[model samples]
Target: MGIDYRGLRDPNAEYTMRDLAAESMGVTADRGGGRDVEITDVQTTMVDGNFPWTLVRVYTDAGIVGTGEAYWGAGAPELIERMAPFLVGENPLDIDRLTEHLIQRMSGEGSIGGVTVTAISGIEIALHDITGKILEVPAYQLLGGKYRDAVRVYCDCHTETEGGAGPPDGKPTGEDPPAADPIAVAEEAERVVSDLGYDALKFDLDVPSGHEKDRANRHLRNAEIAHKKAIVEAVTEAVGHRADVAFDCHWSFSGDSAKRLARALEQYDVWWLEDPVPPENHDVQREVTRSTSTPIAAGENVYRTHGQRRLLEEGAVDIVAPDLPKVGGMRETVKIADLADLYYVPVAMHNVSSPVATVASVHVGAAISNALAVEFHSYELDWWDDLVSETVIEEGYIEVPEQPGLGVTLDMDAVEAHMVEGEELFDEV
Candidate 1:
């Protein structure tokens, strides 16, 4: 006997697009966060995704890309094992279901940090990538249609400087150097401006102007007022009025610290003060906003709009930056954008990693109505796009091709060549 149509036969239809999406993709599981999920594979490949220490790509027979973002020092493969069974045969396209399942695994601890999200973010990206390929459209189209064609790129070229001077000569602190004085940064900014013929630079404000100056004021001692102001003064002075320079504070500040620094550095004509005082402390962020004229922006550390709505509603920032990969890949980032749109808050997709993320951010940048800019640290790194199937940056702008999926296919050969120690295709993470 066939099943009865309980309410459908009543002739009163109550359904929305969400029901359709849910029905199409369907929800089958809602596992909690972190578990003893063991790894079948420990794949590690270095692309442009954040710091290149190799990423663990956990896969299933379903052909999903669970790109695990293992932190600087943390084991993730083991967690993957505890969660794998709950996900086996579960539909990858059903993002809502997957999110719920992952949330469940997150358990009573109120959720986990790097491992849980990294696993979720990876699976989400693979599923979306598959969906884009299936639909013969880019992932952004799935998130929403294109809102802009080209994404603006901000060169994150870093260099060392001394005492409010300019970028120093010689190799950049040997490929990647620890923090340097403000003068070293200024000289490097000049080189990019004059020699490289580029504008839009990104500088991390961490070095203090001087020890004496810092010790003179308790407020400026650690992650201080002097350091930020010094970096800003040097970079802007060297780049002049022509270039767009953004300071990435990396969420290393207290409310008072950011406010004091923002107020002092306002003269540098900062394009934006980013991730100041962490993603939490929205109240402190609001206080900072109230105190300074600089347009405060934060979100790289933020996940989806679910948590972001609070910060946006509170008017804590002028710009919202959702790191595409970090916030459950592309779709969630778009969801973040939609919410940001309602609040009249402009969004800027954060592309912290390689081409997969960059391509996804491109689509979001193109489709988001209130998108202001797209972040990029890729161009600054060595052979940043070498692993990508396709990448193009022209005149400080990146254009997304109207191709299927993300318009990118990871160079598997290259990935394999650099795969960490013992991961094989069927290694089973």
Candidate 2:
């Protein structure tokens, strides 16, 4: 515990130097984008319900390739295809320049809902990756400098809950449904914390596993609190000591209900109460923070600093979780965190998807001073890492790869193998 900072991994791990990358830099410029690169191919997949992901592989007139994920929902393909005219022959690496251009292009476009921004996010990420590769620095260095050598992780463990993150591929092989009973949940938390080396365990305490509708069974407000308390007791007894316990209200409880529930659950030593009130009410958030000794956290649905200004300024919660993809790109997210850090609030990113997003998130988390942890949900996804070929993460930490760029190489073959049928851009757009 005595700042074991001396003598760690070799700082000079052999990698192609920046000069080497610069020498070979624009190799992809042949396929480079500006406003001229055509979005020749777009692939989309629904990785279970609500887990839709899309990969936009922009092919430049120069014949180089850059990939990005505009995935949030089914809208990814449409967004990419719709913006095709603008992106087809353009430079994918000029993210800021292009974003500025595209913002006007997309202005007055649509609601900029789950789809449009997701598309923009995909393009930004790919450009960043390409730029990183060109520079030969791990993406983290480009975003200033890394704050930590490795990122700490926490598991939502919702996959095991009844309706946790959706039914497990609907092919029940007797997996026992992720220990929904509080005692069993506590046991699982203990295993993940004591054994798995996770610093935090955030249980889905808002509703019973598998049933969103069952939350109504509580009948009265007191019953709801009692039910929540019982669930907390079951797991708190199981997680035992040391590991932090937190609850994600999932925006289920209103302001009053949220504060009441936070107070009730405090006895079990909850670490932070998350998203209890909806993201809209700043005053509600302030009230919740003032009402409870248990810390508060939110901002997953919050966007760029423009979106996060009021919440962070008001000191609404103890921690802030920016959905790296959902929020604006890395630069904007860093700005949001800087504002929060001024208030001494920390960050815990919300990433519960495939490895692509995970790797991008790791770079940002590694670079930020106030980052608490990167949400490690998909490490349990068996074939997940096989999709991306890189050593971006190791053991319980995100190992900053010596490789240039985002440090993640997509195994196209693996992606093709898992490619859901009929997803190939068989037709135009």
Candidate 3:
């Protein structure tokens, strides 16, 4: 192929920018077994799950379609639609180059962070799926191959009345909901371990403690800390060594309060304390992590590897939990893992997406050497696994798919049944 260098600078360039850039990078048509394929269209649909799951599909001229899920947000679907024109006619096999092209092209839309990157992340993931299918390999193989056949999952458990332990009439019955009582919480934890066969679980500690005078200050009262500690003690005692219990604070406390809470939980064999302080201040996060023997996990709020680099460099967290879809797709997450590995920090993917993105996280968990566990956030949602053809997580682990691309096919019937109110299903291929 002859290079037309002036076309690259032309405003009315006939060649797509991606093709020009690929040629400039010496990416030949012979790459990925010389197969020629071009992206035809990109489509998105929202499935209302625990969080609204934004599903993305990239269609090709060859009739092969790749499916992916973006981290849900208000403008994600619109952003993906706007980006579709940039991807059309580009080879799906040049995954990295094309991902960067999208990022650079959409920088005005905040590609460095937020919904723009989330949308691009979905497109990047679909490219991986399509490329893997084109090469007749699993998605994990495209991400530097797998280190494990199955990825262990940690369930994010919740009580029946988590937000408020009150009755339907807003009347305080004599009986409080299980979420408010330590024994009830412990009993639920025991049930999840004994019956569900999960070895790892996470519960929220940022629940209403009833001792708060002001929540905007992010300060936790002594009674609040004591109540949280009681829950931790009870649950840890109930589960014992059968399962590792982690507590999530969701970045809801002050540095002093988080330090106190961490100190209180040091008696038990807690798995980790997640996001004790706001993620913006790395120094505060580092101080909190260094103050306690309990493992500290953070990073779900940030964007690409750049957003996570400071946390790792400053030893802010023991575990780095980057949501694959929210963070910059699979390859960017691999880069994050590689950086965390340098500091010996384990990668525990913070996932709240549907089976599509959950399976995508499993592929990433398989590829990275520092993977600890991928989160299963939808255990309470009965129809979560039904979104896909095969069961995504079985016995608390997702068996790395040996089939091409993401392996499991979407069950369109289930998706159509659960589609968001205003969204339309993907057109038939």
Candidate 4:
């Protein structure tokens, strides 16, 4: 005799007798809980944003679809296609198990850390969206609820005169040299802070200083250090206490030079110096962090929790900046934040994705207690928020959605208008 699922229903349980009857008949009831919904298909498309925004969609038998994005890269969409078969017929709610399965199954393809993991990260985020919608809760609630109603956002501003040149042979053109004007940088910073209302801002500090003799050696000359210092001073002085200012080096300097640059900005109330040295060597990164009073931030290049272990364990970074779409998805980023919190480090997400991943990152930032801010890299992209149905950021902050799943709907028209050339659109469900 088969056990009756109807008898298992409790008076206070969410599902009613009618819902249980539907489940016994293999029908999906209201709120998607009656019957098991399997993954029917996975699709991908690219949006030509600041980067090629790789968008993913996971379809279910119940007709519910979940959307996500991978960090912009060449191979992510293809890798998602390669992994789709394994997810077919599996329950989307089993997110952790499926993520681990993909990590192990694709271990040979460098899933331990790189494009493969980025692909899996995209799928994992889609799963969370599905699970949250089915469970009738917001995505941050699926990640263990939220700590705040809104997440602070930091804008990335570019100065008018910040430009450099390189030759076709991969050599520095030396002709253009770095011409980051302190005055122009300050003007832009003031406009973004005062006019745009961003309390946190970042400026690029890794441009040609017009004083480099050997660019490949990754050494900063005294003149180069002075030039960078001037820009930092001008921006910080321009913003004053109204906004906190950070600078990014893009990991383009050697250890000694990175330390020198960090020391030069110590006198100012700098937010942090980002990715001062290469990510491959944690010891050198740690040495640079310990060398100066200015806080050092990194980790956008790293992949999963294991990839971020040494950086937090050895105090390599004073602030952790994980790109959610790139760093093993949402849950993994929260785990990384929990690990950082144990060591008293804060999180600042490094983001350059579309409003899709930006909203996804906001949910993660809302869930984590130690979150500092989420980076907004597309302020210049006039149509960045048009890709979604709702306004993502307002007054330099993202309000956490109370609606189930990601809450924001993709504007198909905007997506079609900005779709990357030659890429196929998602099939109509």
Q: Of the candidates shown, which would achieve the greatest lDDT relative to the real structure?
A: 4
Off by over 4 Å in 1: 1-77, 105-114, 161-181, 193-198, 212-218, 221-227, 425-429
Q: How many steric clashes between backbone atoms does each model show? A: 45, 25, 0, 1
Report the lDDT tens digits of candidate 4 across residue range 322-356.
Answer: 99999999999999999999999999999999988
The per-residue C-alpha lDDT of model 2 at residue 266 equals 68
Candidates ranked, most accurate by TM-score first: 3, 4, 2, 1
What would you estimate as the lDDT of candidate 1?
0.61
Error of 1 at 393 (Å): 3.2
For each candidate in turn, the TM-score is 0.75, 0.79, 0.92, 0.91
- Model 2: per-residue Cα lDDT over 120-230, one tens digit each: 777676667766665567778878988787777677765344344323233444442342556666677777777767767787765644333333322226765676677
- Can you tell me which runs of candidate 4 are displaced by over 4 Å? 1-35, 165-174
Model 2 residue runs over 4 Å out of place are 1-50, 61-64, 111-113, 159-180, 209-220, 240-242, 391-393, 425-429
**Model 3, span 102-167: residue lDDT tens:** 898888998999999999999988898898888899999998898999999999998854555234
- Model 4, residue 159: C-alpha shift (Å): 1.9
Alpha-carbon deviation at 372 in model 4, angstroms? 0.3
RMSD of 4: 6.4
lDDT values of the candidates? Answer: 0.61, 0.65, 0.87, 0.88
